[model samples]
Target: MNEEQLFKQISLVRQATLKQLESVTEAQADEQPEGFRNTIRWNIGHIYVVQNSLLAKFGGKPVATPSRYIELFAPGTKPADWEGDIPSLDELKQELEEQPLKLKEVLSGQLDDEAAQPFLSLPTVGEILNFTIYHEGVHTGTVKALKDKAAK
Candidate 1:
């Protein structure tokens, strides 16, 4: 598939993720149900962080992450260990909602362009972006499962 299609898929997945998070409260977002290592909030923040980080890494744009977002949400960071203020679910939703558009804007006409470095055998911006689609879907599924457990 091409860049436009990838962007559309990204938007669709993001919208679905937002819908899943629609009625979740801050308390609910913070909940880590049995068998889960991270909370819903952590998953959401992770989605935001990973996407922006990929674009910045492959697209060569500056990361626009909020202060400490990387520290809080990057790989291996966990909510159980956090000791500071975190972005509200509303803030996370806003960033997640806007990111696809921002990516489209920054990456227009550049999707097929090669990345500076290959990511796990994936070359090209589009390749990494396609991997991100799968990545987000996995996290989205995790969020759904977490939401279900949290509701119980």
Candidate 2:
């Protein structure tokens, strides 16, 4: 896809993900229902962290996310193992809300550039950004399921 289209998709997908959390409470954000490994909060933070990290790592953009987010939400980290202060749901939402614009600002005109190192054979920055859209959708679905279960 072209850079404009790709960034638009990123924004739209993020909006859908945020829409899923419209009714989620702070308590619900932290709830790890049975059969789930992480909470809604973790999924949201992961989405933010992964997108920014990929853009920085593969797109030659500066890292816009805080280091603490990597420690809290990077792959293999889960709510069950979390320690220290975590961002509130609102804070995460703000980050989520702002991320796409930040991505566009940083990555515009650079989408076709080759990755510093290929990831999953996604050799171009644009391809990796495309992957993040799918990744975020998966986590957004998880957030939906977790929210439903937590409401019970």
Candidate 3:
């Protein structure tokens, strides 16, 4: 997809993800629904860190995160096993709100620049941006499904 379309997708998904996350209380965020993968809280932090890391692969550093969170919530981890420094629900929400704008600024300025490098071996800048949107969709869907289950 073109950078403009890609950015629109990111903006849409990030906003929806934030709305879903905001619906849950901090207490609800503490526990994963049975047979579910992650608490909404974990997904929030994971989304933030993964996008940040992806940008870093292209030599654009994301805001620093505590090492403990990296160990606890990185991909392939399950919620039950997480034992890292969990940020407050509010902090996670704010990062979710802020990251897309940061991403947009970075991408808007560099999409055509020869200086922009591949992130994590992604063949194109488009691929890296797409992955970020896809990642948000995954967790946003996860959180929505879990919330539905909790409601029922």
Q: Give one digit per residue, the lDDT tens place, for model 2 in 29-105.
A: 99887799999999999999998898787666675779999999999999888899999999999999988898888
Each candidate: RMSD: 1.2, 1.0, 2.9
For model 3, where is the 10-residue window of minimal lDDT? 109-118
TM-score of 3: 0.80
TM-score against native, each model: 0.94, 0.96, 0.80
By lDDT: ranked, best first = 2, 1, 3
lDDT of each: 0.85, 0.90, 0.73
Model 3, 33: alpha-carbon shift in Å?
Answer: 2.2
Structure candidate 2, residue pairs in collision: none
Give stretches of model 3 more than 4 Å off.
Answer: 58-68, 112-121
Q: Which digits, one per residue and each the tens of the lDDT, describe model 1 over residues 1-152?
A: 87788899999989999999988998999988778989889998999898888867765655477658998998899998998788999999998988889888878888888887778777888788778888889899999999888777
Tell me the lDDT of candidate 3.
0.73
Clash total of candidate 1: 0
Q: After superposition, how far is residue 52 of candidate 1 from its true place, in Å?
A: 1.2
